[model samples]
Target: MKKIDNMTVTQIKEYVVTRQKEEYPNLIPMLKEDHRAAVKKIGQNLEKKTAARDQEVQRIEKMKSIESGYYDQGILNIGGIDEVGRGPLAGPVVTCVIILKPDSSRLYVNDSKKVAKKNRETLCEQLLEDAVDYAIGQVDCDVIDNLNILNATKKAMTDSLAKLSIKPDLLLIDALHIDTDIPQKAIVHGDATSYAIAAASIVAKVYRDNLMQIYHEEYPEYGFDHNMGYGTAEHIKALKKYGPTPIHRKSFIQNLGLK
Candidate 1:
């Protein structure tokens, strides 16, 4: 019988549920609609905060997974490896290896595909500043042609691990396991599912985007700045008109009759 204004949010919620089940049984439809609308309004105010907290929890859980592995072996070095530019037509495959602190709080770290370019850039900068160690390795067009994309991707990953300032006891790779003596796990769709892999994905993507932006200045006709070396209609038309640049992967162009 107490007024709604006198009740706490939780009390009000319980009251609403109880009323729906007991006093409002005859008005179930209207009561249910009102309850839903009130719950939605409360959720609207809390959704952003709730999402951030959830992301933090997910990040911590991911870190704990890696930490558990390290703790079992009593070793601290753990690395995450990911690659970008695999599907692009006119750029090198770039891979990044990142050794993060077990308790790093790098914000806005998520799958590169899920983040905007500006956010990725900001995260990349913050990651570089906060990471224990990180390295980038690139395999160019000629190497990609000779070794093929799979092997080239592996090589890029290996090279990135090699360039790391500190050696890792555990390697978390995105999908492809490199041929290495290092202890490694290949996680499918890791960029979306694994925090470490997502961080590495962001690093690799930002690095390759910058590289392609530089290439754009040299080959303005291909629209590398806009498309980032992808096979967009503009890029393909430019290839037909002016032919492939030195940076174009020859193997990819074979299907396009540009060889």
Candidate 2:
């Protein structure tokens, strides 16, 4: 085998990329004491990346434990209920009810707020595709203005639950109780603690963000693509300068003094 000292920098990088922890033992012996700086830097990065991945796996297992407790109780179909856009100044409140298979091993699943925007879309697709049953419900700004955000959010969650083809034995909801005869446990920060609720949060966040992106095409002044109708400085500035769009929640902006 060629020594790392004799290998080109490009070759060293390739080796680092392709190598795994099992090969790390061999790597140490191959490195020369004085000239191992480049290899050491790259190896450190690889180690850090591996460590982060392992940490995420452990966290996912902890989150999955919530569902496992239900599975232990003979509840096969457990649904996760979560909603997005409740605090946004505009756009609709979107909710998702999703039932994932008990044996799901998707490491990327986590609280939607913890995920980057691009990764959320990819994870959303993966979650939907792998789910045993999933459904989305959206309540527009008009309904929010009429019914109030909390009641409208509950409405959206219940609507999504109703749309699911396979009714769940139990619901793990994030913070709010839905008006449903079906059994549910309203968990504070369920999106961070429960795997099922986190999956639903991701789906709901992505779906609402997409809708806001579409709305951005019509109202580019508000920067909906990035802010997702949230009350950001830019959005508020736009609301003051350009006035409210049709999608703006009248009740939400009434205090803002935007007509």
Candidate 3:
């Protein structure tokens, strides 16, 4: 092995990358005092990253604990329900029912609003792949305008549950009760507190975001790719200039005075 004093900085970095996690602490000690500063900076950065990752893992475990007592009682298929696009002025409200395996990775799971878009997309893919059972339902803007957003959201949620391949023994839903026979607990901001609900929220957000991207191609003036059909200034400007599309929720947009 080359002595630390003889190794170039690039070589030392390569050595650090190859070292096992347990070997990191001892690595700095092996370096000469003159060579230690740059290497020490690298070690500090690694330590900080590890600490952040560990903290997130602990949070995920805490969130999963909500299902532990139920699992102990033999309720194995616990689906979480959540929806996206309820507030959007156009496009469909999308709901997801997801039964995440107890052992599925929960790192970075949280309310969809709290996650970055790129991370949400990545987590959505992971959750879908890792889920034991999952389904999605969509209600178009026409239904949202007629039934009203709250009732439309409930219908979408119920539809998602109906489409699940495996019937859930119980449901943990985010802040709304669906019209279903299954036993359920409505948790306010559940996506932020429950692992399963957060997973559902992430999946629903990504699914709706992708839909909006497609809508953007059809209606480039509305900027759906970025606004996701929300009534942003750009969207409102487009509404005033060009009028509502088939996807616009007429009931919600009446206040905007768009003819």
Candidate 4:
């Protein structure tokens, strides 16, 4: 049956399933704004679901049966370590060490940078419940200035490892080696390639983002709420207009003359 222009979007969707799309071109266009929006949302939902499924497949490919590999060698407590806030001009470097049970590995995990913020929060909660053990460490801007970002990040990573209740037999570090005396492997993109690292990355990212949100209230001038201290144009403009806040990294802001 030909779709009439007067049909509601609900009816239009039904007709679309039963008929070729070309038969109902005007039906959707004629829909009220709300109905048109609903139709658009349906399309968007399909794309999101497809993307999620593809991500799952890619994650499996990248992890490459890593969970089984650890188990085969009798390594039960495998930790993945990753950090965030290293590049921000302000705020502390945050690190997380996550040790996931083998069963928890199948959960959706990816590099914190790759996951959307809201989804990362959701994943963070799930990872926490699923993980065998986890710990978070933060080295604030003062410590960062003292030790430098590279060393500060390493220090935070080690701190996180030290706090874990269950000591990890093996460590999967993201692009940096540590002196913890624990055996460790550094993967160039460990967060994307390994479950533990990815989970840790999520924790660190969520933790730091929350900290910046709190900092936003203290120094509203820097636009910390929006830029999260990444030195965006808005943040830089505020820095020039208001000079430096206590949280600003002294060495990092040398060009801005915030001293």
Candidate 5:
């Protein structure tokens, strides 16, 4: 005689499971069918709630993992570095260095490419506010063409780290090691796997995106805003028609037979 409508989904399910067998002796078959229907509805609701909680827990666990690593090292001066524009044909290669607070373990930090753009932008702003130290560095298109992307990226990372107001005791770099006296680790796919690298990735991505948007205003013909200096069909067509711009990497264009 208890009202099922007032009970939560979890309570409804528990009640049904516990009472079904005992009530079978006295209940009509129709009543058992009603119990089955109630149980199914409750199960669906519970599953949805459980899934949402699981996702939240996973995000928390990821944040804890990063926090624990920094705690274990006992070093407050940990810097994360990441680069963007390695694959782009035009625009400068950019890198960012970020030193997060030891106690500020925020969830939802992951690779910039894995996250939505809006979330990346939001996180970039949040990290900037929360970081103890942060800096961005760039190597121009001419320099990228002269040194190549690999070396250019290294230089950008180094420059970003050098500009940091607080010196870092440890450097966590994404995929490339820079020549520095500071202890460093070059982690492959670090942006995807490490929280620190992921934060750095978002900063670098947002910074580079803003720069490309500015370039788009200057050169609307090449669609810099849409392609971000990448070699899309539109970009290639523009290159063929207008020739290389100052921002275009001459080495890459020469290799592609466009220069």
Candidate 6:
């Protein structure tokens, strides 16, 4: 009913913020075209925000189910284990163990391979700050070559578990078995299915990716920065052109017939 056109920019914003949804239809007709568009957009944006918040709540609830499934019998110190770089022709196989709090639930946390690099880094930081306890270990190219990738990954995971300040009562492993005295469950694709495993994957991936970025400075020919030591076509070409660096896993390269 009033001349909204006469209102200042700040007044219009204030009015939009304060106005209820039911009042929008009446107020929209009185406003100019730009203001009307802004009103509709604001309503839509609000709806989207509400939907996203609800989805996040559901995700959090789903993650909590894993917590109850395994640790409901009063086992609070459950560690999730994961490793990265088994397929890489260069760099070490890094592993991480994360012990999340009993009441912890991070909806943003997911399988490291599923998350963006920047977001993975952010989540890794959050895990370090929030986890009850955490540790990382790496099996270098020398060790990987000596024991093979599978054994090397197991060793790295076990080493990570050993380093945890509060030793875990139960372990949730992301696919492979670790040689540890502690109890563990090897869940296929556990990183995607279990919240704790996902946290460990994020931590290990970010940590290992940083190591590859550093290696990029020394081995610029392999594009380690982008591939994170994975054996891509460019990397294979570089291997042929430049030959193997000290970090290159000899056993892995042997398969490429690039001796």
Best candidate according to lDDT:
2
What local lDDT does model 2 show for residue 55? 94
What is candidate 6's local distance difference test score?
A: 0.83
Lowest summed lDDT window (length 10), candidate 6: 27-36
Give the per-residue Cα lDDT of candidate 2 at 184.
93
lDDT of 1: 0.80
lDDT (10s digit) by residue, model 6, range 32-67: 354567654554655565568669778767865777
Best by TM-score: 3
Q: List the residue pairs that clash in candidate 6.
A: none
Model 4 spans > 4 angstroms off: 1-55, 106-108
lDDT of 2 by residue, 1-259 (tens): 4467777768888876677667765664454342668766765666677678889889889999989998998997999999999999999999999999898868878889999988998998888887999999999999999999999999999899889899999999988987888899989999999999999999999888889989999999999999999999999999999999999999999999975
Q: For model 3, how does the per-residue alpha-carbon lDDT over 185-249 read when each residue is reduced to its tens digit?
A: 99998999998999999999999999999999999999999999998998999999999999999
For all candidates in order, the CA lDDT equals 0.80, 0.88, 0.87, 0.81, 0.80, 0.83
Clashing pairs in 3: none
Clashes of each: 0, 0, 0, 0, 0, 0
Tens-place lDDT per residue, model 4, 177-233, is 988988998989888887778888999999999999999998888888778789899
TM-score, cand. 6 vs. native? 0.85
Error of 3 at 189 (Å): 0.8
Those runs of model 2 whose alpha carbons end farther than 4 Å from true positions after fitting are 1-9, 20-35
lDDT-superior candidate, 3 or 4: 3
Q: For model 2, state the Cα shift of residue 224 in Å.
A: 1.5
Q: How many backbone overlaps does candidate 2 show?
A: 0
CA RMSD per model (angstroms): 7.9, 2.5, 2.1, 7.3, 7.6, 4.8
